[model samples]
Target: MEEEECLSHSSPSTDNSLELRLQRVTAENIKTVRILVSSIFPVSYSDKFYQECMNNELTGVVIRNGEAIAIVAVKPENFETGRVLYIRSFGVHPRHREAGLGSFLMDFVDEKGKLLKLPHAMLHVQTSNKTAIEFYKNRGFNVDCLVPQYYQRCSPPDAFIMRKPFH
Candidate 1:
């Protein structure tokens, strides 16, 4: 994505009042990203995870009104055939749901994958999270496999590896 491209969203009080933009994660916004992830997911991330976010070229946050309302952190991984974009963390703030922010971040991921010439994008989601499963499926992801007890502390603990192949 361009360094300063803006996404305009309409508001009840004013037309296109909310301005959103994708920005790289930095020391200044690291805490905000940690909080955003905690609020959206049931998992706790390590300091190393946040540290890696700062260095990953594909990691970014969606800032709206100068606050981070969404995030998509990704990295490349080698599977059996080739390297794939591994979506480490991706979510929009609960309050911002259904506003197309999720899709916006996803489109960003797709563009990055194509630019990098990755064969596929993959992520794991809790099997119980039907909403997320449906969302990924709608974006052309399929369950590659079931990982039992993928999460140590989460109830049901199982996860499904969802993958979207780039054609």
Candidate 2:
């Protein structure tokens, strides 16, 4: 795996920062998030798909300094009568990578899930995306299953379903 340079952005501040708040996706932020997705992932959906996510209340964004640097879309599922938060899409802007922003955003979700009594958090990642795989693993995610050709539409890559039990 090739190591990419860690990108950094101005740290989020409370005084001048544009309220780095987490809110249900709005029409304005949905467009911005779509662009973000397209930039990070090879395959991304149309504007309507983003709008659907916003309408479904599955999307979230972190606004900092009046810019959306991180975003995630979660799909809550009932598995064995226990609620699991499936991280559908998650990304931080390239310029914001390795700035503790990704961990901060994920920690925010994990804290929220714990407060809501969600048992575990789940997500899928391309097998060849070693950087992302290692990042999640370092954060304590363990692989539960593998899917072949999972990203056929996006890339010719296999996928791994990972989960972390939030005790």
Candidate 3:
């Protein structure tokens, strides 16, 4: 991730035209979200995984402009016997990034997790993805653990599992 100059933070209401809406993802949007994921990650979306997201067993959000511009998927997990949410895929369109959209989506997820009473929100980031690591860390995520050779096919960086506790 490139270290571009930080943009000014804007209030949610200030960017009403560039709305960030969170809804239960449907089958139709899964493909588009998959495209979004593929654009950011090295993994390809499998048919079964897309189906699971559309089935509502997994939670997702679509940030759109009459079409999916960005998407996030979370799988609920039982951590420490408490409900936890792991962000499975999160990506903003390359064209729309650096305009506060990522932060908006993240804020939306944080609110949703709080409402769901999740103990913490977790995600894994490649060590080479400095921009994503900085973004999460700035949003209160702490590096919880490191896994070696996590994405062996794509890059040679260790995986950093970061988590942000809600309570």
Candidate 4:
């Protein structure tokens, strides 16, 4: 929560009717990001947990009017993969899925990784979430491995460790 600078990023909507604006996310934006993320994956956690995630993570969010409808969080070089940008969390509000928001944020992350000299983007997704798996696959991500019990807090706690490398 050092510098809370807001930026506007425009992307296409689901209907391709209007442009959706995105911006940098800080600790103050965690509440809305959490809500968006929880809508996709509900986990019991506190503000401190999310605050830590946003402390230095590269997070982008789409706010409509006054509410966040999408969010993507990333951690730089904090993984076993050297020079990798790990996608800690990503989600679009249930009501806003299929909109170009997810793709836009993902493209932003790719650009972000390259900017930081990181070429890999990694994330863990529950195996049960077929929609998400397909979404990642369509975006050029591939399953690198299976993380058993990765989602221990949830039922069917297995996850696929997916990774996409920048060219």
State the C-alpha lDDT per candidate: 0.81, 0.70, 0.70, 0.75
**Estimated TM-score for each candidate:** 0.87, 0.77, 0.79, 0.83
**What's model 1's lDDT at 69?**
79
Ranking by lDDT: 1, 4, 3, 2
Which candidate order results from sorting by TM-score in descending order?
1, 4, 3, 2
lDDT tens readout by residue for model 2, 11-130: 353345443445556655555666678888776666666766674545666654446678767767776536798787788889878766677667665765676688889887988888
Better of 1 and 3 by TM-score: 1
Question: Judged by lDDT, which candidate is best?
Answer: 1
- Residue-level lDDT of model 3, residues 79-118, one tens digit each, is 6536678887787778777877778777766766877888
- Kindly list the per-residue Cα lDDT of model 1 for residues 121-140, writing each as its tens digit: 99989999999999999999
What TM-score does candidate 2 reach? Answer: 0.77
Question: Which candidate's TM-score is highest?
Answer: 1
lDDT of 4 by residue, 1-167 (tens): 34445444455666666676666666566666667767767555566657765644376677775567887777775666666888877888888888677888888788778878888888889888899999999998999999898875887898899999888
Clashes by residue pair, model 1: none
- Candidate 3: worst-modelled 10 consecutive residues by lDDT: 1-10
